[model samples]
Target: MDSPFTSKLGTNYCPTAEDAVEIQAFLAQPLRQMECLDRKIAELQHALNKLLEEREGLGSIVQSHEALLSPIRRMPADMMQEIFLACLPTHRNCVMDAREAPLLLGRICSAWRALSLATPRLWASLHIVDRGEPPQRTGCGRCPSMARTGWSVPTIPFAAI
Candidate 1:
């Protein structure tokens, strides 16, 4: 019997059994490609979700740090001074880095830098020790001599020394 589906060239387009198999195989290629694309989309969605979650966690941490910093900014000047004084090292070390003090204090903010600079006693204590032979007896470590003048004082505040 002649198939209804026919090309202008008179070929039977309503496939025979063998032809049906080939047609099904050809159709399966697109299905397989679609499945692969679906899997990739799902993986991308999971990755995006994970990144969003991480961003939220980091945002919360930033907010917490900002909240913590706000109180320090609002602190009374006199009280802040006391806190800065209390934060000073009790012992002076000859091998100290003047850079270290400002660096640590600067971690807070500009106000901290000003406060630390204003406190002369905070930089006054110098206790340089020479476990080995003193290099020159005139200078400490890599710190500049100008910064070391505070240490030259015979005695600093007892709390500071």
Candidate 2:
């Protein structure tokens, strides 16, 4: 919606230096009238803030309902598991890095974590190149043992633990 405090400047809106001078003169031409405009401006600002809060609330409600309509919510668990399995590296092995796909799958949602962990195929192929175990809290929050024991197959840590 257009702002309630519609600018006095018209649709044409081409102000010259003379126009600026004239406008300043007009604003001060009436004593205490600027104070009235200020009050109106404050009132409009309050109304705008309230509208913004209301819009945020309305958006949240819409967001809450959006989950129910998602096709992902309706997909069969078996189908999702198949999809998750396909996401794993076929020729090479998967790194334990949280940034990559198979590992990243678990962190996305509880259902995904369960599937990724349960599917033995997802863990069957892994090729890790650990720069080094990250120091505690350096980043990525409590890093997992990546390529530990010289990358002799992680043995499906997600499934095991």
Candidate 3:
């Protein structure tokens, strides 16, 4: 069998000892590197084809052009009010801690923002039950008198209602 180096150099041109050693070292490295590169390329191509096939199968469920908005301009006002009321606290003294969540909801779009701000009842109920026992007299929440009175606020306090 003809070696690669033999074919590259004419038979009359014999390599010096140093040249032979350099050529052997260079060839040995590239053979291992080429094998590693070929294996990695095959693995990547296989993964790419699998992803392409999966994406093609999703159809309208994954369609990029689908509209994000509701088909209607407005839902009935009474229904909206009922939904908001459903979220209200059933007991007195419950403070609505939903301020952050509602603000985030409103930020999604102009209509949602307007609706969230317009609905006062939605922000009315807060569950003081989650606030834990009234802290001892030393220091606690902003309502020091509330802790001193030992009068637990109901889910929706009368003052808030």
The lDDT for every candidate, in the order shown, is 0.61, 0.68, 0.55
Residue-level lDDT of model 3, residues 4-113, one tens digit each, is 47665656777789879968876887799899999999999999999888878775555644444445346776675565456444554334343534334456568765
Candidates, ranked, TM-score: 2, 1, 3
Better of 2 and 3 by TM-score: 2
- Model 3 misplaced regions, further than 4 Å: 1-74, 99-110, 123-161
Judge candidate 3 against the unseen true structure and give its global Cα lDDT, from 0 to 1. 0.55
**Where does candidate 3 have its weakest 10-residue lDDT segment?**
145-154
Q: Count the backbone clashes (under 3 Å) in each candidate.
A: 4, 4, 15
Error of 2 at 86 (Å): 1.9
Task: Please name the candidate that would achieve the greatest lDDT relative to the true structure.
Answer: 2
Model 2, TM vs. native: 0.61
Pairwise lDDT winner, candidates 1 and 2: 2
Candidate 1 on 97-124: residue-level lDDT in tens?
5455533664567778777666555555
- TM-score (C-alpha) between model 1 and the true structure: 0.45
Q: lDDT rank, highest first?
A: 2, 1, 3
List the pairs of residues colliding in candidate 2.
Answer: 93-126, 93-127, 94-126, 94-127
